[model samples]
Target: MNVSEPDSSFALVREFILLGFSCEWKIQILLFLLFTTTYALTITGNGAIVCALWCDQRLHIPMYIFLGSFSFLEICYVSSTVPKMLVNFLSDKTISFAGCFLQFYFFFSLGTSECFLLAIMAFDRYLAICCPLHYPNIMTGHLCTKMVITCWVCGFLWFLIPIVLISRMPFCGPNIIDHVVCDPGPLFALVCASAPTIQLLCYTLSSLVIFGNFLFILGSYTLVLLAVLSMPSAIGRHKAFSTCGSHLAVVSLFYGSLMVMYVSPGLGHSARIQKVTTSFYAMVTPLFNPLIYSLRNKEIKAALRKVLGSFNII
Candidate 1:
C-alpha cells in the first residue's frame, strides 16, 4: 500500500479535531461544569489520601504505601485526560499531530503504570498474608522504593515503543479523532488508512502490553484469594478478604474498562459507549480508588481523624 504523507495529501491530517460529547451549546456548558466538579473532587480526594499517608506514621505500612502511590498515579492519570477534554469542550477541539501523540504518551504511561502498580500491590498482599513472618524482611523500605521505581520504568518502557512506532507514520489529511481523548485505537485507524505496517505494529504492541499486564494481575489475585480462603480463623479470613477486596474492586474497574475499551470486538460498540467506558477509568475510577480504601480501612480512618484534629489545633 502506498502510504501518503499527511502534509502532501489529505490522507493523513496534521491535526485531528476531537468531537466532544455534544455539538449543542447548552449541553457543552453542562458537561464543562460537571467535568470541572468531578476533577476538583478527584484532586481533593486523592490528595488527602497522599497527605494522610505521609503525615501519619501508622499509615506507613506496605499496603498504605502502595495505596499512596496508586492515589498519586490516579491524580496523574485523570489530569492527563480530563483537563484537555474539558478545554476541548469549552474551546477549539482541534489538536496538532504532535499534541495528540504527547497526550497518548502521558496517558499510556500513567495507565500502564497503574496496571503494574496494582500487580505489585497484590504481590505485597500475598506476602503479607501468606508469608507474614517474612513479609517485613521481604518487603522492606528499600525494596518498596525499588518496586515503585520499577513500576514506573517498566510502564514507560512498554508504552514508549508503540508511541515511537505511531509517531513515525505520516499523517496526510482527515484529522478528526472520533473519541474524546487521543485514543490509540482511533489513532491507529487513521494510521491504517495511510500506513498499514506501522498501524499493525502499534496494534500488536498495545495489545500485548494491555493483555500481558492484565493476566499477571489476574493470576496474582487468584493466588491471593486462595491464600485468604486458607486461613483458619474467621477474623483472619475476613481481615485478609477486606484488605484485598478494595484492591480487587479497583483492579477490576481499571482492567474491565480497559479491556472493553481496547480488547473487545469494536464492531457494534458505539462512540458513546467508548466515551463512557473511557471515563470510567480516566475519570470515575481515580475518584473511587481513594474513597474505597479510606472508607473501608480502619487505619486510614484513624489517620484522617488525627490529621483533622491536628489541623483544628492550628
Candidate 2:
C-alpha cells in the first residue's frame, strides 16, 4: 500500500472511539476505581523497587541493575496506556489517530524491550549461577550498560516494523477499537480490510520474535535450574532458585497470557477473553512484578528497609 499518498477517495477517520470495558456508567465508574487503585499500586511498587535499587549499595550487581530497568520500563509501559484510558472512561471515550499511534509506539517499544531485557536478565542469572567466580568480571558495568542499550535499541527497531506496516493501511470504516487501550491486535483488526497481507506478515513476524525470546529465556532458565541442582548445600540451592523465581513467574505470566491472547485461534477468542488476557500482561503483570520481587526476595526487602530506615521513615 502506498502510505505516502493521501487517498481522498477513501474515507478518513479523524479519531478512534475506544470501546472501553463497559458502556454502563456505574461499571465504568467501578472499573475506573479498580484500575485507579491498580495504577497507584503499580507506580508505588515499581517506584519503590527502582529507588531501593538506586540507593542501596548492596544492589550494585547486574541482577539488580536489570531489575531496576524492569521496574522503570513497567512504569512507562503502564503509564502509556492506563492514564489515557482512565481519562477516557471519565470523560470522552475518544482518542485522536495520532494519539493512538503514539500510544501504540510506546507500548510496542516497551513490550519489545521487555522481551530482550528478560532474556538478558536470564543470561545474567546463568552467568552468576553457572560461573559464580567470573560473574563480576563478565557482567561488568560497561557490559551491563551495553546489554541495556541493546535491549532498548532492538526493541525500538522491532516495534518500528509493525508501526510502519500499520501506518500504510487505510482506516476508512469503523474506527472503534474494542478494548480499553490501543494495541496492535485491535488496530490491525480495524484495518484488516485494507491490507490483510501486511497485517498477517507483521503479526507473524511479531509472533516469531515473542516466541523466539520465550524459548531463549526458557533455555537459559533450564541451564540455571540444572546448575542449581548440582549444588550440594540446600541453602545454596534455595538461594539460587530464589534469585530467578520472581523473574520466571513474571515471564510465565507475561508471555503465557500474551501467547494465549495472540497466538491462539484469533477467530475463536472472544473479545471478553482478549480483554481479560490483555489486562493480565498489560495491567496486572506490572503490578505483580514489584510485589513478587520485593515480597519474595530478601535482598530487595533489606534494601528497601535500609533505605527507609536511613530517613527514619520505616
Candidate 3:
C-alpha cells in the first residue's frame, strides 16, 4: 500500500541524495584518501586474522574461534557502509530507496550481531576463568558453533521488523538524506504521515538490543573479574587480566562510539556530527579491533608469525 497523507501534494520519493560532509573539494579529497587508507587497513587486518586462524592449529581453541568470527563480522560490519561512503566522497552519490533500505538493514543487523558476539565472548572468558573445569565441557566445539550461528541469526533478525516498518511508511518527499548512511533517525524524519508508533517501536527495539546484550556482557565480565581477583597465583591472575583486558578494551570502543552515534540525544539531527561519529564506530572501530586483539595478544602474535613464516611473507 502506498501510504501518503491525504492533503499532501508531494510525490513518493524514489531515491535519497546523501549530502555527506559539505566541505571544500580539498577537504573531500583528503577525507577520501584518509578513509580509503583506513578501509584498506581494516580489511587487511581482519583478513589476516582469519587467515592466521585458518592456518594455525594451536590457536584453534574456543577463544580464538570467537575471535575469528568477530573479526569476520567486523569486516562485514565496516564494509556495509564504508565502500559506498568512500564512493560518495568522490562523486554525487545517490541511493535508491531499495538500496538505502538494504544498507540500513545490513549495517544495523551486523552491528546488532556484534553486541551478541561480545556477550558471547565474555561468556567464553567467564567460562574459561571462572569455571575452568567446566570450560571445555560447556563451550565445546558443537556448542560454540551453535552459539556463533545464534549470534549471526539473532543479529540479522533484530532489526528486520523495524526496517520493514520504516520502509512501509509514506516517504512522500524530501529525498535528501542528510548523512552518509541511511540511519533510522533521518529516515524517520522524512515520513509524510504520523508515525509515532513505529518510531517508538524502533527505538524500543534498538534499546532492547543495545542495553540487553550490554547488561549480559557486564554480568559476564563481573564474574570473570571477581574470579580473577580471587585466584591464588599471580601468574594466573595476570593471564586472566590480559585476556579480559583485550575484550574489555574492544567492548569499550564499540559501545562508547555506538552510544554517541545512535543512542545519544537528537539522533540523526546533526548531519555533520553524525557523519564523524558514525565514522568512528563503523570505520575506526573495525580498524582498531584487530590491532587490539593481535597486538596485545601473544597467542595471536605467535599464530600470526607462524602463518607469516609458513608463507615467508614477513
Q: TM-score: which candidate is best? A: 3
**lDDT string, candidate 3, 80-108, tens digits:** 99999998999867998999999999999
Candidate whose lDDT is highest: 3
| Arranged by lDDT, best first | 3, 2, 1
Candidate with the larger lDDT of 1 and 2: 2
Query: Which ranges in model 2 have alpha carbons more than 4 Å from their true place?
Result: 1-9, 265-267
Candidate 1's TM-score reads 0.91
State the lDDT of candidate 1 residue by residue for 1-42, as single tens digits.
998654544464678898868668988899899889999999
Residues 1-314 of candidate 2 have per-residue lDDT tens digits of 65697667668877898887866899889989999999999999999889999998878878889999999999999998889878987998899999988888888788889989999999999999999998998999889989999999988888687787687677876889898778777787777366666667766767877898899999999999999999999999998888789889999988988788666645667778877777778899999999999999988999988888987988
**CA lDDT, every model vs. true structure:** 0.83, 0.86, 0.89
TM-score for each candidate, following the candidate numbering: 0.91, 0.94, 0.95
Higher lDDT: candidate 2 or 3?
A: 3
Clashes of each: 9, 0, 0
Model 1: colliding residue pairs: 6-171, 6-172, 10-173, 11-173, 12-171, 12-172, 12-173, 13-173, 16-175
The TM-score ranking, best first, is 3, 2, 1
